[model samples]
Target: MSTPQGGSSGGKVRGWCPDAWRPMMAGDGLLVRVKPRLGRLTPAQAVGLGEAAVAHGSGSLDVTRRANLQIRGVTEAAWPDLLDRLLALGLVDADGGREGRRNILVSPDWKPGDDTHRIAAALHDRLGELPALPGKVGFVIDAGAEPALSAESGDFRIERGSEGVLLLRAEGRAVGVPLGHGAEVEALIDLAHWFAKSGGAAAGRMGRHAAPLPDWARGSVQPAQPKAAPAPGQRELGTAYGLPFGRLKAPTLIQLAQTPGITGIRTTPWRILLTEGGMPGQLDGLSLDPNEPLLRVDACPGMPECPQSSVETRMLARRLAPHVVGRLHVSGCAKGCAHSGVADVVLTGRRGAYDLSLGQRAGAPPLRAGLDIDSLIAHFGAV
Candidate 1:
């Protein structure tokens, strides 16, 4: 149904990765990510997405920690074809400009008539009206009966209070201000204006900005700490599956749809995927087993896949997982796109070597520099 390129299917040119409209160039190929509506994919849509990836790009599709699907390793000649296929599959925004603006995350557990969907839908239609915020700056609509996006909420959050009222929260704030579900979009846009007015451009991200929230926005209730997602397996939603490092082979996903019981695909900010039904007994590189140790590690494309890295990351991480304690992050470089938060073990790649740090985030300075995977394993043994 589509054409492929001669020689290599992807390239190794890497720099600033684009979010919507255009694909980001990577070592393998061009990466085109699709942010699903409310972060969901119907079974039919999922099949189409997997096929599109196989037909036009690399046979691999990456499920980002942001709950989006990215077709990896596409050649320059194949990008346009990939765009056409994506549009036909209803996987992208026809208007590239709006595509970048429509960044809204909702609780995966939300239902049709629930506040999460209602609010998210309203905001989706009005995305063009809001002032331009940072591409990564996003909203988490967790208005489900129980708050579901405590950890996933980015700069701003619209969540439900214990009393069943809607509250708007800014990241790093201890409490949230009470608002009706009706005010979610307008209030958020106003905050964007507020953020820009307070020198948000100079100091990127809400948490880093020194200015305080506007006077009108005040703490009505203390928000709870975020809890980890439900472990792998069947739940009220469906059977859950985990990818070793959030990578899913497109052909495998295509086959997964052919299996019985599956009806839809839902993803989390984590590397977990929840389908409408149980997965077909076994899937290569996909984990139905909840306790898999590979699930504890986070990694990004390194070395050959990304120009930023000097070493291969995931392969080494996989080898080191058995020796490392708690969560591990194998970042390509200091940017730390894979795991933003701190982890027990972090190995950041730099000029073909790794900087090791304990109890630190990916971007932080390491305790020791220029260590290989063996040293990493030995560090665990020594401690």
Candidate 2:
């Protein structure tokens, strides 16, 4: 595996920061995200995105935890042309506010006209109806009688209860408030207003706020863990794909993703892709084997790529791949965007060196400090 280098960059956007109109700058080039509506990309859209990545940027692509795709290494000069191409492909959202607020996530397995799809589609259309929300705050339309995206990322969710009751679930809370099937959207909109009114200001994500749900709205206390993704290889629905990291080359996606007689592709919070009718075949960078060691790691574009990053992350992770077991997170900085929660072992970069945390988030103070990459690897390589 080749190490990812940030190189020298010219732009000023933070690493992994994505918006439709305002692309973030990285060490390599501009990083622009392509937010597929409901995380579903048509075969044509996928091909066009692959072409756009090649033409306007580096051919590298990332599947985000939110199930959106980011195009990496786009130059400043190519942004306008890239936007034009995205517009032509019906992928660009001109309104920055609308684009920012359009963070709805759906179960990739949702079928047309099903409850998940129906509620999700309705929620998408009604985004404008909700109060002005934090750009990062989003709703998870996981209503399919049973929750398919419970473990998936989202702040608010719509789900059906055990008794076939519809409920509005909050991210931090275990239980959800019940609502009638027809009233879920209105209830969701009301919840948004409540969140904003409760001082969900600059820190727009709901989980960050301390305000509790309405007394009547409080339901269960059980955490909603998103369901595990399909094991790689052929499944009844289709084939699921995984990458060494969350990213892959455009050529790889364009070629391997669009197979003969396939309909569309689905992305997961695991950073894997699902081909509806396609099966797993040979792919150089991706892991067709579900148990691949690299799959147990998480990392971000550090140093040159992210202005906030403190060191190089991907290369160190690649080297540490064989020595570690369970789960490991290599965060460029204190911000643990790669893995929001704790991991079995975390390597956080600071001041060009790394702070090692035995079992905690990257932000937690390291058990040891001022260690170089070599030292860090030697210690944990055997875990």
Candidate 3:
């Protein structure tokens, strides 16, 4: 129920949620987290998690913001057994306690031959080689495609360029590295180590620190183009849905999986669910319209659940949803736990009221309000 220290360098790592939702951690000496590639899991892997959930602390699992899966309710006694099961399913990466440091994002459609996957794999392997590095040091490999978590950014980003070269961005500044199957991947790890050693404060992500890069290190960045989504025949049907405060009931998850044509399910770091091969007519029943107010907003669990949260952020977000435009983030406190990249609008809780900001600019004048939901929505609607 306590907030773990920010970044990977701290102590007594807290689970993502409360015990009822089944929380796990890396160095906590009790619970363990299992992160899969892009949150993709085979049917057998899914079954293994279901069994592990039941046998461990609680029969529950949490889908994290980084498109990874965590099996909660794991106990000290069950760690080895659960790990063995996960390893058998090919879910566990090569590193032992280093799984938390391997945060990589790639196109959901990233296939075997793609350079993106190769680079991501190389980076992950290299991180595994550096056991001394902090557990939270991570990277993202964006293949410049849909259903990708790349837009969220990360400590390092490898974006594809126009001339078939890969553009590397570290701490936000564009750094061009030689393009090859896995050459840039090595360069990225070297950059990470250098950044860590140089006392470069990991500012939430690579892009956040990009502004300070030297001119020569600032390589040309590729223009991001919107690609037409693949047709239903070529692409699998995926539905994005959020779990209130990133917690989903075990039975609900299992039942949701039972729907026909729902072949796979992946979790985004934003506490949303992406189900692939959805039932022919399932989209109609669920409240998942992306343009809808509920889908456009996100909040951290505040108040009773998190002692540090001064207000109930999710309730406020839901109440103010109707007037929200674009993507909005509501944090219980200034920690901004729910977000990795900046949102179009941000509402941070202070005392009994709220402090709001517009656009990407930070530390502007606060739009003080009585914290009334309707008034908040009206203020945002006016913007």
Candidate 1 wrong stretches, greater than 4 Å: 1-17, 224-227, 278-280, 381-383
lDDT of 1: 0.78
What's each prediction's TM-score? 0.91, 0.91, 0.72
Q: lDDT tens digits, residues 1-383, model 1?
A: 33322223243343333553666767776678889988888878888888888888888888886788888877778777778878887778887778877677778877778788888888888877767666667778888666767876477788877656788888878688888647888888888789878887666677777797897777767554444686777788777788888899988787777678887888778787777775436777788788788999999988888766778988888888877779999998888878888899888888778998889998688899999777876777732
Better of 2 and 3 by TM-score: 2
Better of 1 and 2 by lDDT: 1
Candidate 1: worst 10 consecutive residues by lDDT?
1-10
Which rank order by TM-score, best down to worst? 1, 2, 3
Question: Candidate 3, residues 93-144: lDDT per residue as tens digits?
Answer: 5444455565676555565667666776676666665434443446767654
lDDT per residue, candidate 2, 1-383, as tens digits?
A: 11122223343334234665767667677678778887788889889989999998888888888888888888767777888898788776766566767788887778888878888777777877778775567888877655677766678888767667777887777678777667877888888888888887655577777887787668863434445567677766677888767988888878875677568888877867888786567876777788877888899988787777879999888888778877889999888878887888898988889888877998798799978977876786543
lDDT ranking of the models: 1, 2, 3
lDDT of 1 at 364: 81
Task: Give candidate 2's TM-score.
Answer: 0.91
**Residue 130 in candidate 2, Cα distance off native in Å:** 2.2
Question: After best superposition, candidate 2 residue 300: deviation in angstroms?
Answer: 0.6
- Tell me how far the alpha carbon of residue 197 in candidate 1 is from the true structure, in angstroms, after superposition: 3.7
